[model samples]
Target: MSAEQTQASGVVGVLESVGRKSLGLFEEIGRFFFILHATVYWTFRRPFDGKEWLRQMVRVGVDSLPVVGLTSMFTGMVLALQTYRGFERFHAEGFVASVVSLSLTRELAPVLASLMIAGRVGSSLAAELGTMRVTEQIDALYAMATEPIQYLVVPRVGATTVMLPPLVAIANGLGIFGGYAISVALMGANPVTYWEKTFQYLDLNDVSSGLIKAAVFGLILSVTGCSKGFFTTGGAEGVGRATTSAVVMGSVVILVSDFFLTKILF
Candidate 1:
């Protein structure tokens, strides 16, 4: 082939490969959502494992608090600082509290919390289940007259869905406090005025929308992790890949879904 023709063919091949990978990614994402919806449907169908659900709930929600709180605190502080500086230039510094609270309650707190959970809980779920699948424990369960999906997947998904929103709400509160502290102590914001402005601008919709987003994000994490793990083949290498994919895909899904939710809701 001529040199230029060869180069053009190679470039086209590269673009085609990229397109194929992108299509595969979107397909995996679609499957992830479908599995999540199915799991949620199954979760409400029959009696749940109360003890297992309780334990998973505590692990996912209560145990996640410290990390979530720490993340939210710093996020709120940074938001206040950056926003305050911009508003200060316009002599609208008093709007800092409103800005901080509205942003956190509407998006940041829930989205960040969900991403953190996906990194922590989602990876773990994938690894654990992938390990079981590799070790043949999942197969054993299937042979024993036990349903792996019901016992393992359902409780985990149920726990995440039930737990995440409340955790996000808690994160929102902590984030607000963090903003309040930074504004009053560092920025010289008047405490009374700050609270007044925050209250004036805050509404139930902001909080409710954020919580709803949290629930959706939780489902995404749980389902993607579980689906990847459940279908995992090979051995340790496969499990490792699933774990990595779960976290990365779960985070991407959260960000994408967050945008669409925001657009639809607000």
Candidate 2:
């Protein structure tokens, strides 16, 4: 074949590969939406497993508080320090509280807390379900006429969806306090001024907006993790892959969705 023809063929091959990958990505997205739909449908069905739901709530919510709190506290402190430094140049140090509080309640608290949960809880859920998949436990449930989506996925999705708002709320408070401690105690900003400005620009809408974002993030993480787990193949290697994919996909969705959510909420 002529060199020109060969180069044209290679270019065509590259285009074909790209097309295939793009199709595969869309297929995966479709599957994820289907799984989310199934989970929501199963959630409201009869014969509810309140015990399992509560157990998942404890696992996903209660167990996640420490990491979320630590992350929020440190984030707020660092944000306050940075904002104070910048504002000091303009002699607007008092605005540190407003910035810290607004940033935490409107963006950082929900995003960071959800990312932490995605890393910790999402990976764990994927691993657990992946292990069950490889071990045939999930198949066993099917054999017994039990729907895995209802028995397994619904409780988890419901728990995370219900619990994340409160977690974000707690993280918001901790983050604000962290900023307060840094601005007032460490940076020598006036305590009264800090407290006043912290709430000056903050209102119910800001706090509720963050909580709303957290709820959406919870749905995305749980659904993605569960879908990855449910579709796991191979064996131990597959379980590991699913776990990693869950965290990566969860984090990505959280960030991507955050922008649209913020635009809508704002």
Candidate 3:
């Protein structure tokens, strides 16, 4: 082929690839909405399994406590330590408590806790559902006159949505406490001053905003995980891919949505 023709064909190939990928992304987005519709439909029409909802709550919330708590606590400690050093240089050390409290309740707690749950519970949901999809277990449910979306997806999504707010609330407390411990016990800041400073400018709005974000993040994780697993193919390999995708997508959506939620709430 002529050089000019070859270059033209290469350009066309690149454009085609880009177009194909864009189309694929949109197609997947459409599938997500379809799944959402099915879930909503089943949710209102259900026999309503309380056992599954509670089980998933334990799995997504209770099982995740230690990891989320540790992450939030250390984050607060590091934040306090860093801010104390910086603020001390300017003789504004008192603001450290306020900064730590605001930062934790407004941003860090929900984001960090959600990210932890995405890694743990999101992957677990995806892996479990993907395995069922591959092993014909989900199909068997259909064959047995059970609607899989009702039997499976609603409970998970509902439980996560309900539990995440409380989880983030606990995380907020632990994180704030960690900051207090670091400032007062470790660095010898006055305990009374620290507590006062922490709550002085803080109010319900800050904490409530984070909890709202947490609930949204939970919905995102459950929906993403369930969708990925429900549509999984290619056997074990697909299951692994679905699990990884669930975690990655859940984390990314949580972060992206956090920015928008912060703007709206604050």
Candidate 4:
């Protein structure tokens, strides 16, 4: 073939590839929404499985407490250390408590806790559902006259959404306490001044905003994880891939939406 013809063909091929990818992405998005819709609709249906929901909540929230706690506490400590160093130059050491408390409740606790949950609980959701998919257990649900979305997805979605707010609340408190500890014990700040400053600038609005963000993040993570797993194909490899995608996609959605949530809330 002529060089010009070959180059033209290459350009057409590239365009075709891009078009296919774009279409696939949109198709996946459609499926994701479908699952989300079905999950939400079935959530209010009769025969509410409190047993399964409580079980999943334990798995998603209680099981993940240590990871979330450590992450939030360290995040608070790091913020305190950095802010103390910087604020010391300006003779604003007292304000370190304010910064730490406000930042944790307003931003760090929810975001960090959600990301950690996505890594731990989200991955498990994807892996568990993906395995059921590949093993044909999901299909078996249909054979048994069960709505998979109701039996499987709703529990996870509900558990995640309901549990995340409380998790963020606890994380915020622990994170603030962490900041206070570091600022007072290590930095030699006045404990009374630090404790007083912590609440001086913080308000209910900041804590409420983070809790709202956490709930939304929980919805996003659970939906993404369930979507990725529910439609998983292949076998063992597909389970692993879905699990990875669940974590990555959930984290990305949480982070990107955080900016918008913060803007709207704060």
Best by TM-score: 4
Cα RMSD of predicted structure 4: 0.9
Best by lDDT: 2
Q: Candidate 2 on 1-266: residue-level lDDT in tens? A: 69999999999999999999999789779868988999979888987999999999999999999999999999999999999999999999989999999999999999999999999989988999999999999999999999999999999989999999999999999999999999989999999989999999998999999999999999999998998998889999999999999999999999999999999999
Query: What would the per-residue lDDT of candidate 4 be over residues 140-240, giving only the tens digit for each residue?
Result: 99899899999999999999999999999989988988898898889999999889999998889999999999999999999999999999999999999
Q: Cα lDDT of model 3 overall?
A: 0.91
TM-scores of all models? 0.91, 0.97, 0.97, 0.98
Tens digits of lDDT, candidate 1, 198-247: 87999999999999999988988998899889888899999999999999
- Which residue ranges in model 3 land beyond 4 Å of their true spot? none
Candidate 3 lDDT score at position 52: 91
Model 1: weakest 10-residue lDDT segment is 39-48
Write down the TM-score for model 4.
0.98
Off by over 4 Å in 4: none
The ten-residue window of minimal lDDT in model 2 covers 24-33
